[model samples]
Target: MCKEECPYDFRLAEVVSKLKEIQARKVLVQLPNGLKKYYPILRTTLEDLEIEVFLSLSHSWGVCDLALGEAKKTMCDTILHVGHHGQVALYTLSDIKIVCSPAFYKRNPIPLATRGLKLLMAKGCKRIGLFTTAQHLNYFQELREALSEAGAKVHTTQIFPWMPGQIIGCRFDTIVSNLDRKVDAYLVVGGGIFHGLGLFVTTNKPVIIADPYSNRLIEVAEEASQILKKRLFKLMEALDKKNYAVVISTKIGQFRLALAQKIRDLLRGRGKVAELVVADEISPSLLLNIPWAQAFVIVACPRIAIDHQEEYPYPLLNPGEVKYVLRGSLEEYTPKDSLVPNLSLNNVA
Candidate 1:
């Protein structure tokens, strides 16, 4: 049973409005792995509204993973993607009208345990910038008030429609945009070390977690360090490599064919052998089949190399890390652009 403590609820009016506007029939519903639980309720609601709907069972990491094939398979003319807003990925679905509605929390400032605040206070965090996922945005004002009452000056920056002082796993431009502010520490209000560590890698600031799910406040110093250490070790392994496989994606949003070709050209110019390996989904077992490849420079989904380096047999490196491996010498090693390519945020790489 979803209790009052549950922070996420679908905005039915907005979702329904968009669906009706598009005149959608035989709609295909796509949800992130975590948001799939609400599908039954959603199915029932849409059925009552006289719209045929079916669910996509594929794994949805972010806006990057859209079930276009599943939609076509189900003969769906329209797709309703839940949980995340399609900001990062540029998917060009012409015939299918894809409507993205984020899971909004009705309650403002969900009273997660105060232990996270206490932990931050103990670590001498007076000025705190409370960051979280989109699901937790409604609770920010309440969180800010709580922090203020606890004798702390909190700084919160809004990132327009997608993230309002909150962040996703892939995008950490919030910290970059807030570099002018005098923030002592950052509090990632979401679950897991993924978002926290992403912030740490980009800003190198002190990051602590105020996880609502576990209701435990913890520091990410150990986890962040471990991730960096793993990345550094992978770079060391790839330092001597000449032959490399540039993994490319066929997925619409994640397809970096152009970037993959550019990296390949750059590698060839530098007297290195490069091959383009096309994949829809990248996994260790899939890559293990082709173990002939010396090293892999990931072009699709930066998280594959960032979070899952140990899973791969050879060195799996990011674009910037690959450059360092080619150069064999670093001007004080640090991560350039994280996931995505050299857009505006990743100009460093």
Candidate 2:
């Protein structure tokens, strides 16, 4: 649940009013994975407004494709996309009227447990690293100072090229890789799973995540643990997994495709036989040739790759930072262990 003073309610009301005015018959409402908690509320609200809404099960790319199809079929007059700054990848200005709501939380001026300082004092962790989504960077300077006074060295990286308000998933990896091996442990301040989990997975290190609105450090840690356990089980099933041929594309715009290639190489090095599915453009027909492939990993810009793979059940590896699970054959691949850490919070103020 959001804090009692959460600002998203007012914004949701405004967006809903705009949506109602359009009265689209086959409206597409794309909800981000982070906002899963509010899916029921959003769906109920849209239904109450008498709008025929279809929720895209996939991420940004999938949402765009659904909206595009609706536009092509003349099935819907408008699309309402919601979530973090990264959801911008879902549309072109011509296709749909995009409304972005970047979520923000006010951090208490007081430090919460002085995590950085405690690490420094206890383990001599001089070089502390800080990473978070773009929306939360406004308070970074203060957070940095608090850590510094706690006798720890600090380094900060902003994953989004734009301001905190405009940052999204597109720049996640670029920022995360910049901090590789640079600090002892990472400290993340955000409300969603993408930012923290993305950092945790790629960096392969212990991360301390803190959220001010609710008791998210523990909750998120639990969610991450469950996800990791599922991922691990999936990996184990793949031990005898000869049914799938992973595809890597050279298409320049597909960063996820490039990352898919990297993952393919890693898998092959571990004795898996994966195939590269190169194409001028990603389409269902082009992917159909690999009938033996239980899953295809398309790495490209999220917009193009995800738009193309909307109907597929294969898991997608996003270059932007997070490795997302898509609805399809790979859903059954579950892990045995949790990858996130459950750190206790000291909510000051």
lDDT of each candidate versus the true structure: 0.72, 0.49
Evaluate candidate 1 by giving its C-alpha RMSD to the native, one decimal: 3.7
Where does the lowest 10-residue lDDT sum fall in candidate 2?
A: 336-345
lDDT of 2 by residue, 158-262 (tens): 544444322233434454556666787666666545555655554555566666555345323466566565544444343455444544434322324545566
Please tell me which predicted candidate would have the highest lDDT against the true structure.
1
- Runs in model 1 lying further than 4 Å from the true structure: 1-7, 86-93, 104-114, 158-163, 336-340, 343-349
**lDDT (0-100) at residue 109 of candidate 2?**
24
Indicate which candidate wins on TM-score.
1
- lDDT for each residue of candidate 1 in 1-349, tens digit (9 for 90 to 100): 3424445677766677766776778888888888788787678767867889999887777667777888888898877787766222222396777777667655443455256666777888778777777667656667777778877777866654555666777656555676526777787777778787877777776788766767666688788788788777777778778888999877667787877887888777778888999988899998887767788988887878889988988988766555565566544677644453542212233
Provide the lDDT at 248 for model 2.
41
Candidates in order, TM-scores: namely 0.87, 0.50
Give the RMSD in angstroms, all C-alphas superposed, for model 2.
11.6
